[model samples]
Target: MNFSSKLLQNAVEEFGRLPGVGKKTALRLVLHLLKQQDAEVARFTSSLNLLKEKIQYCKECYNISDEEVCEICLSVKRDKSTICVVEDTRDVMAIENTNQYQGVYHVLGGLISPMDGIGPSDLKIEGLIQRLRQGAVKEVILALSATMEGDTTIFYLYRKLKEFDVQVSTIARGIAFGGELEYVDEITLGRSILTRVPYERNVG
Candidate 1:
């Protein structure tokens, strides 16, 4: 797509930098935003600015939040004895939408992807071990994706947590092997969580 204005092209390029957004889609979005009322566009940009400036990670679970701790971690309604572990904040949101989980979450931030240079030390694994050491949690549910990296991370986590008194489990493979948790249908994700399996080190 050729643009007559360098400014417009630059805007489109910036928008295209977002994950999964192609150049065509970015151009369409930038044009749409330009067509909107000035006040409306201002509001949209302002909201994004606020997000960039104020977004914070929950200290306990590593989930994205506006405060030191996420609302789910702070909620008394959630089950304190069970924690659903996920790869990131997006996974947390995905499971939350299913409404099948009443337990709190522990966001690892990323899977243990050796190909991608991500390791256990790069995630929130230590914090999780500390949480278990607190002696309040009875179970830890591994709600990672079905990818090899996810499986590897779960294995490492299982080894680290096997010594703990807490029970470790993984969501059922309702989704395909390579499917991400966020992309799975809500019903399937919910059912997977409901019918979770014990974390077996020999499965690999």
Candidate 2:
């Protein structure tokens, strides 16, 4: 087979580096991009660059933001007395899409997975503790996934925050086992939030 054009191969390799994108799909995307006009390709490339250049993690919650603090953390309408704990910014977006939560959030970056070598200290847990110590937060909702790693992360947080005196709860298991928040419907997410149960450190 005559592999023509190093530029096309380079584009395919770059796209393939993205999560879940296979070599075939990457090649397809590269071919599609090649068919686009130079101006359109420029626009697409610029937008991708802008995403990295414009967004930075909010210092308080670790959520992606274009400024020092995310819009959610700065909004006066949001309840500062409640914080939803999530594994990543995608989960924050998922919950926000429901438009049912009024509180701010704390992104843990990732969950606890001993097999994956991710520990409690590897997450943004210290920031959560700092926020709690600052007071005024009445509740902390654990909105992690229903996986074993998610369960482990929640348990670790439950123990860590037990001394804070603020109510700590977990979003209900209304979401199917092993379901990721990003894949759940808005109504189901809202219901799970509404039916969240208090965290009893003693129970499983």
Candidate 3:
């Protein structure tokens, strides 16, 4: 696309770099921003700048947070004995929307995708193990997506967590194969969580 202004072209290019944003969509976004008042544009950019500068990862669960620890991890009302393991903050948000789980969460940065070079070391597995070692947790639910990588991560985690006394379980297959938690509806996701099965049963 040709642009009369380099500033507009640059803005479009930058916006296009975002996932799922094509050049056309990026152009639309840039044009919309350009139409906004200067103060409104400043506020929008300021919020993004502040997010990049001040966002913190929770020390305990590695979820995105404004503080050193996420509110869920610090909540007294949460079930400290049950930890729901998810792929990222988005998955955490998806699960939270269900309002069916009182347990806290552990966010693995990503799943174990060998093709993408993501492995256990690339995730927050050790921190999760450490939490389990502290002995407060009684159950660890593997709430990863129903993809091959998700299954791989769950199997690896099950092996590692089996050494611990905690019960290792996985969300029910109410989710079809290859489904990501973020895209699943709240009711199905909530029911899957409610009817999780022991990880050992799926192994053989």
Candidate 4:
């Protein structure tokens, strides 16, 4: 193949590697980029590069940040006594879009999945425990998914945090089983936050 053809194929392969993009969609994206002006493609590539180069995890909450701390963590207007724990950055974005939560967040990076070899140690649980030990937070809200892994992670965190004096809670059942927070509507997420339940141990 010629240089231009090879470039197109490379772009398609890169796009294909994305989570849900197939060969056809990858090809479409490559063709779309090809039609754009050189400067436009440059701008797109630069933005993509900056996503990795500029963004960093907030030291306080583990959320994505352009600086040392995320905006939510830095905001004095937010309720510092509450911390919402989520499985990923997308979950953080989902809850933020709801505009209902006034507290800060702690992104666990992932859920506990034994089949996938992801355990509590692999998440940010240690950070959360340390944060609780600081005694500033009065509540830790588990905003994890309603799936099996989500439940497992929640239980694990609950067991560990039970020793702490802080109150522990989980989002309500407004979200359906097997549903992901990223796909849930903002209104549903807001309602779930409004109707959160305390994390009960040994419920029959």
Q: Give the TM-score of each candidate.
A: 0.82, 0.82, 0.84, 0.81
**lDDT: the better of candidates 2 and 3:** 3
lDDT of 4 by residue, 1-204 (tens): 243578788878889999999988989898998899999999999998999788899999998888898899999899999999998899998998989999999999999999999988999989998999899989999999888999999999999999988899998667776889999999888877887666583131
Among all windows of 10 consecutive residues in model 2, the one with the lowest summed lDDT is 195-204
Each model's lDDT comes to 0.91, 0.91, 0.93, 0.90
Off by over 4 Å in 2: 175-204
Instruction: State which candidate has the highest lDDT.
Output: 3
lDDT of 2 by residue, 1-204 (tens): 134988778878889999999999998898898899999999999998999788799999999888999999999999999999999999998999999999999999999999999999999999999999998899999999878999899999999999998999997556776899999999778978897767683245
lDDT of 2 at 114: 100
Off by over 4 Å in 1: 174-204
lDDT of 1 at 84: 95
lDDT of 3 by residue, 1-204 (tens): 879999999999999999999999999999998999999999999999999999999999999999999999899999999999999999998999989899999999999999999878999999999999899999999999988999899999999999999999997677766899899989778978897878896564
Ranking by lDDT: 3, 2, 1, 4
RMSD of 4: 7.2
Q: Which pairs in model 2 have colliding backbones?
A: none
Clashes of 2: 0
Regions of candidate 4 where Cα sits further than 4 Å from its true position: 1-4, 174-204
